[model samples]
Target: MDIFERKPVNHAIHTSPSNDLRLVESAIPDIQPHECLIHVRATGICGSDVHFWKHGHIGDMVVTGDNGLGHESAGVVLKVGADVTKFKPGDRVALECGIPCSKPTCYFCRTGQYNACPDVVFFSTPPHHGTLRRYHAHPEAWLHHLPDNLSFEEGSLLEPLTVALAGIDRSGLRLADPIVICGAGPIGLVTLLAANAAGAEPIVITDLDEGRLAKAKELVPRVRPVKAALGEDAKGFAGRIVSELGQEAKLVMECTGVEASIHAGIYSARFGGSVFVIGVGKDMLTFPFMHLSSREIDLRFQYRYHDIYPKSISVAAAGLVDLKPLVSHRFQLEDGIKAFETASNPASKAIKVQIVDE
Candidate 1:
């Protein structure tokens, strides 16, 4: 098949309101004047995608109809619109996935925090289609060129890396700073890599799964992995983290949405420290308000990333982080439903599951 030739049928994976997945065929999308039509080569299955697949909604964002699922993706440019100037056919690129309003008066977009723009169109989120299809059209400005050293899989992983970068930036992490990471999931693991690259030392990461903790230790040999004991209270888990680090952490990166994990993060931080929440939990969460308040520990929350793609790509290209080790499973696009099933299953021990197009 010619790379530039558009296929007659575009195969896409979508989640319906019935809580089922389907591989459907549709017409290839056309590019706008400033857009580029990309042939998606790789897409990572995110937890949110799985949540939507099983529950038919995330929070108030309901899937009233069939919605394509996938946001972390990489592709080769098949065609560029008349106004597209930075890219040509055959250029490899990673999709940023969030399209925020660029209006000058939009406070969030004008200030460079476009991720918080009220009118932003986020892929895989309810009401907006995503990049799971074979061909997707996106604005050239939203796509970053993939370097020669990075594979399409690595390019797809950049989206989650951006989240880690944003969290690290928001935490004000410094050289050799002692830190605690809650949850050893994909986000937590990527945050560990980012923290190591930033020169943080004696990092302690916690998770309920011993396998994931073992993987975390394998990824960062110097990292101290702490396993959460079954039936242990939040305070007890927090004590365990402190004991493992020999002191309270100055910054806690809470990557799990579990309430116990969140509480443990708050309790594990030292006085005047900060706990940055990167996970998406329930709408209402009850926390130890007085405990955090009395200790002056700032509780910060992070949404999707803003403008960290360039840094993420640079970090990957420079070999500061090896993304390949994180991918535990892979499948072709035709088996996307099975991919989701494996990702959602705990017994599979899957870290980052990806669907690739041959």
Candidate 2:
């Protein structure tokens, strides 16, 4: 049976102007010479997806029309383009949502920081459509082969795992080095797993929700979960984290974009330590400039991942970091609306909500 002989009906989940989700039928995207057509098997709903569905925008990027949602995805190659040499039909693969122009003239691309490329087309961001549908055409270079050990659901998680990997890489984390991570959301939990696998000692994760903290502890038994009080200030919360860890951490990964969390991360770090911000938050935020300067705390920001998918896949394939436990809820593609609702509701306790095609 020739899978490409007849095109399949493609249904995509999109965000409507009424602040609701609508599953709409979209045409199967055509593949370019350097691209391949994918039969999307699994796609994880990111926090940004829910934010766009409920608020109609994220920061400055507003949803203009019925924009498709989802970026963390994996699929099987249904068809390969004429010039595509690395992949073929029936191969399992994971999609790297960002496509950067690899032109030699582009400094960022030339320097291996293609994620910072100005001309990069990142899926599901603003005008660009996403991979929530049954079929999508992606560049061959950005599609990674999934090992037999990893399921499509686990493959879909590679994208977020790369974010965790990138955070660890940017922080210069060392073996047995103590660290603090803010927020127990999917990103933070994955960071905990990655940090643990990297042999970080006495990992501390903070969150306001006890359920999320408990989930973190369940995922990594050695992790210390610290609950933030309702009216706790950054300094007080930082003190709590320090007391939990027995000392100030040399590195803090701020996975929650909340301003308070950012401040707490800085305050929790020892003098001359670093704080790596991995979350997306408000555009304009106030920080303790004088304190940061006086303490010589190096604050860095992490953009989307670059050249980390293969390493992330290897980590999952080797069973060093189990990605399955991160999935708290699952739904079929037809139930994408319900999936979004579950992800947006705090009461659902959904660490990661995924839409599966099969």
Clashes of each: 0, 0
In order of appearance, the predictions have TM-scores of: 0.98, 0.97
Evaluated at residue 129, the lDDT of candidate 2 is 84
Per-residue alpha-carbon lDDT of candidate 1 for residues 1-358, written as tens digits (9 for 90 to 100) = 6743645668889988898899999778878999999999999999999889888876787899989999999999989999999999999999999999989999999999899898999988988888988889999999999998899999999999999999998889999889999999999999999999999977999999999999999999999999997678999989999999889999999998888899999999999999999987887899999999999999999988887999999999999998999999999988988999899999999999999986
Candidate 2 Cα errors over 4 Å, as ranges: 1-7, 16-18
TM-score of candidate 1 against the unseen true structure: 0.98
Top candidate by TM-score: 1
lDDT of 2 by residue, 96-195 (tens): 9999999999999999999999888888876788999889999999999999999999999998999999989888999989899999999999999999
